[model samples]
Target: MQDEAFFDETEQLEEASSAPTDTAARKRAWRLRINYRFIVQHTPYILFLSGLALVYIANIHYTEKKIWDINRLDKEIRELKWDYISRKSDLMYNSKMSEVSDKVSGQGLKPLNTPPQKIEVEKK
Candidate 1:
């Protein structure tokens, strides 16, 4: 019985060797190196790694967005500072005694040329 089974296996091997060497057929005959048990056991670790990678990517994006916002805010602050300086200078120039007289002159107002005399009243 052993000799007959071995002889039949050799014959099958010879028949397969004589068969056409089709690349498509060979590709379809691929075998797994890992077992299903190992895959199922390590699935939780794979999912954890995937979750960590996603969190890392999200953190990078959030950091980049914060950097962009900081740059934008820096530009806005610079512009506002310049505006503040210019407005302050304009206010200083416009609040001078000369400018105040000039503006009020159009409305028929004039500056006093002499000091006013003080009068003392006695209470009776």
Candidate 2:
């Protein structure tokens, strides 16, 4: 009976020591296991989400570029408007009678001193 009891105790001790190793193996296998079935099942949804994300990023970049273009165009338009106003003012000043006479005086072009008279001929 004593030998039988000793054999049972030895068996229990060995099982207890081997249990930790078995649990460690199971943990390692669990970590390494890949659930390919689940991934395959959700592949369509994953691809759809990836495409949506790409589109969203592209839209953001496009919007930023459009805003930049609009700002640049607006600045260019303002500069062009200012240039037009300045040129128009210069033309207005140069087209005045006094300014024209002053410029032509140096070239010996004098202003007319007399008003023209109109003559009518009688039908004979």
Candidate 3:
């Protein structure tokens, strides 16, 4: 009877291995059933990891946006500095006496031709 049971078990094993498609289908069904169990067991951990991933992704995007804004502001600051320097130099050039005289010359305002002497008064 033991030998017959062993033979029957071996025959069942042989039948199970005989069809690859059937074995694969059984494996697929088993995996599908286990997938539900896996999710049920680890759902909280999965949700925690998902939240961490979202925070990580959002932090990366926020940092990148901040860096982009910093770069843009740096570029604008450089341009403004250049403009300030240019305007200051232009103001200095226009403030010179020669340029002032030239601008006023067109308005019929002439520069002094000679230096004047101060008069000395004696108390009597």
Q: Which predicted model would earn the best lDDT?
A: 3
Per-model TM-score, in order, reads 0.63, 0.66, 0.67
lDDT tens readout by residue for model 2, 1-124: 9999999999999999999999999877765563665577788998999999999999999999999999999999999999999999999999999999999999999778899889999999
lDDT, candidate 2, equals 0.93
Q: Which stretches of candidate 2 lie over 4 Å from their true place?
A: 1-35, 117-124
Clashes of 3: 0
Badly placed stretches (over 4 Å) of model 1 are: 1-31, 35-38, 116-124
lDDT of each: 0.88, 0.93, 0.95
Q: Enumerate clash totals for all models, in the order shown.
A: 0, 0, 0
Per-residue error at 40 for model 1, in Å?
2.4
Cα displacement (Å) at residue 27, model 3: 3.6
Model 1 C-alpha lDDT per residue in residues 1-124, reported as the tens digit of each score:
9999999999998877866675446545542314565567799998999999999999999999999999999999999999999999999999999999999999999999999889999999
Deviation of model 2 at 98, angstroms: 1.1
The list of candidate 3 runs beyond 4 A from truth reads 1-33, 113-124
- Order the candidates by TM-score, highest first — what do you get? 3, 2, 1
| Number of the top TM-score candidate | 3
